[model samples]
Target: MALSFLSHCLIGLCALSLFAWAEKECRYLPGDSGWPSIDDWSGLNDTVQGRLIATIPQASVCNSLPYGNYNSTACAELRASWTEAETYVTRPAEMMNPYYQNQSCDPFVTEKPCELGNYAVYSVNVTGQEDVLAAIRFAKEKNVRLVIKSTGHDYNGKSTGKGALSLWMHSLKTLQIIQAYESDTYSGPAVKIGPGIIAGEAYEALANVGYRIVGGECASVALAGGYTSGGGHSMLNTAYGMAADGALEWEIVTAQGEYLVATPQENADLYWALSGGGGGTYGVVLSMTTKIHPDGFISSGALQFTLAGAPNESSFWEAVRLFFEQMPSLVSDRNSLQLEIENNTFDVFGITLPDQNISAVQPLVAPYLEELTRLNISYTFTTNFSATYLDYFASIMGPLPYGPYPPTEIWNNRLVPRSVVLNSTANNLLIDAFKLAVADGTFLVGCNGINVADNEQRKHPDNAVFPAWRDAIASCSLTAFWDFDAALEVNLAVKETLVSVYTPAIEAATPGSGVYLNEIDPWYEGDWKQEMYGVNYHRLLDIKHKYDPDSLFYGHFAVGSDEFTVDGSGRLCKI
Candidate 1:
């Protein structure tokens, strides 16, 4: 019994049966309609071969009962590692949704029911296309809200919904490598991956042979959902392109319960929307086939320095300012970098110089290093060369910082454009804003040098990725965290402050720049369509409305999401 709460579902089945007798169909409790009954749910479970799993409240916590096979000691360890990405993916309904297992439920005071907040009522642990089709059809017909989850590493709360039936794709881990994939738009080697495949799994599988693909930096990020669907950025983004740019086709089940294959030639509209349009809104993805590259060499390293003891912060700012000035030349030459600023310490990693070694990069970075030396800022710049991408990611990037369940953080990001980075006035404004954010308790600042999407290949697909991405020199983000026991108001205030201060800062620095949708605040009070998708928003809306007229699938920041609202009690209701 591998920590499964399903086997113990019998405890609630009897009560659900009583509720089934009182109701004949599934409906929203607030709509004066009956919710799904046990009988109705049983039918779905039968069709899916017992794959339906009940949402187990508090199952991931150590204090919860019905611990399955785990002992007290193991449960404690499990709780400690709840922040790890793998932990949430295994559970039925525990990802990205900050309110999960936090809201206080009425009547029940036990370890279990005391904290099942805003989680889906049930989840179909889908393993095949048929299961996805069945789940979609069931939700549409029964008037049940639907959500999709793949590894549950979402930052925008798109993977979970309240009182909904979710399709968990994490178990559908299938990876097939096509030695040569031929298509009208692209003809080359490719990999047809299940929507559930995470970055680490994909990389390990690809490295087993000799290939690489554009993907998320975090090992737990699922490639098919928020990653690729939101225009996946990678260390190789400057050299290759976004993950969406590499997408060739997708197998999805639509709101109408139709299983369709979307590619450049067929279902072209859906393909465009799925490529860079937000996930869990247009349709339910079953599998995605994307382009793959042959094994290649990359120069990678980590660099860091401290400015704490500096006579003035201006010198430190100048050192960072000089680095930004040199970004265009480095990025244009197929080089990418990620610089993390925490207080006075700067930690840089994921330094990718394609087809080059450590020796070759020394000259390019000499000017920046000289500037740092002039400021008397001691820096540690180490370099290494790897023959394969996997080796470089493993050795240079090392293990990613995965979190336990019930996360205590939220993120707000902006794609800083080249214009702002290069302009002296805008650059100073950007630095000042960052300083304000840091002073306000924003602990980490992540800046990644990325290539603009002005190349010929990016335009051909006509993707829904934000147009600003094509003009961006780097993606910048701020992370805000709070104590686990902090009040909801405190968390909300923190997020509000982050958005209020940073959004303006970023906007002033780079006017009209858009944010990376995947990492944006869920309660974003701005023009998301214009901010996230830019000119492509209208077309995305047309496709979304045409495909999901009933608003059957709605993710935060998705097209037409403004028509609905999440109330104080966490109920999603139409405005």
Candidate 2:
């Protein structure tokens, strides 16, 4: 009876896979193309499902609407040019890629400013690998722009675009517990991740096998594309490395529309690039294969803090800094800890220590406790509790509410060096700055630090679409939640340290530095060639020109942007 039931389920899955593999039938024969059989000059006018799918602009109706970025006349002109073969149609690829301009709200404090472009770009719901291959081929043949989006977590708007047709890969998430065809005792079962996989889901999937992939520490961040593409950071990073380091293989849809599998043995250059080259510098990533670690070590809990009611603020900052300094020795490679500061009035810090046992954490944090007590500061730190990935994730983050939950609105981020907090004077200034923000009743803070050593342990993946970081230890982001009116001013004030330190480091470095592609500011523009990509830029360009001669893919950090690069005067230009 059991065998029969299992067989029945297998048959059902086969049928489902078949249905998903079918493609939209083409009604017209594209000239010199293998799609349809017929060939004739007049056939150009013939209507076909292929043409309908390929020719429609990702934002066909955007030009006719009242968008925040354009005046009525300019919008109309932009629309008119798309329907014709004028200068606008000939314009450099990058200009028309965004679903909505990412930087549109940079100078504004709107509630939606935390979000980037909408689902206004491509409207694709692809199911199989063939669909991705076809999308790539179709864009190449039709002279339409192309970009891929999975979770749309990208901050600089690297996912969807207007001139660009969307190749949505989020449907590819197929979580599985499969031991590779050949494996030894050490190999263990691997988690099969799809392009749309998020850290939250991957954790759940791996939990089934008593294991978890060291990916996506951010609850809402996607693991396969967005986070991995930008060298994803996580609570486990202090012990492991960045997310890219764990990637074993990837099924990528290239510029030439070929669906290729990249691994250490095949397409090695692409393998290197995607690990951390930053997004939009290479082909659209389909899915990744990553490392699976033994699960059940996660220690999750939240602690709250308040300065207004507390007797001392300086003591609080010192204790916090001191705790981080001691954090390295207390935890090993298997543990994870995330600290979230809610506000000066009250702060909730969540710690997920995946490497150490629960009993060990209390002892490790004891020194800070004593110091806090000595300074006459009142505080509460939870006893570490062992929990399953699913339970921990659910309890810690809660459910996603309607219209995108506003509380965990830490939508985007950039990696700041620990030096900024530990070594640089920035740490000293940061305490006062955070204190001031809280004193003024304007700041609610959540800080997440991922130990990224495991991510950079091996040679970094230097291709595909991510930036490379050198032996990076952690990625910290500060999110300030505020009322609609106060959001802009508050964020600007919080960003002062970033503007003064991290931003200048990037531009001032003989070569600039790079933040995660998923966390860049829309208003942030730069050559970024050396800083973001290091040595991978030139190689990525060569691949871009080879497979995308007409340069059809141009959304969310389009490649070959030579024509639209920012000039010496910060003027937007066409090369």
Best by TM-score: 1
Q: Compose the digit string of candidate 1's lDDT tens values, residues 1-575.
A: 64467656765797788676534332354233556678989999999999999876544344343434324675556546545566676677776445344444311123443344667779999988889888888886776778898877766667776678889997888899999899888889999998778787788789889898887777778898878999988898877788888899999888887889999899999999999988888888888999998878888766777777455677777777777777787677678898877667667876778778678777777777887888888788887889888877776444632322234357778888888878887887877777667763455788889885666544425677777888899999887664445566777777787777666666677788888988787766677888898888889889998888878877777787877777666666665
- TM-score of model 1 relative to the true fold? 0.89
lDDT value, candidate 1, whole model: 0.76
Error of 2 at 551 (Å): 3.4
Q: Model-by-model lDDT, in order?
A: 0.76, 0.50
User: What's the CA error at residue 448 for candidate 1, in Å?
Assistant: 1.3
What tens digits encode model 2's per-residue C-alpha lDDT throughout 127-233? 66666666666555644445666655555555544334566665677776666622321254556677766666676667766786666544545677757766776
Best by lDDT: 1
Which RMSD values do the candidates have, in order? 8.8, 16.2
Looking at candidate 1, the ten consecutive residues that score lowest on lDDT are 105-114
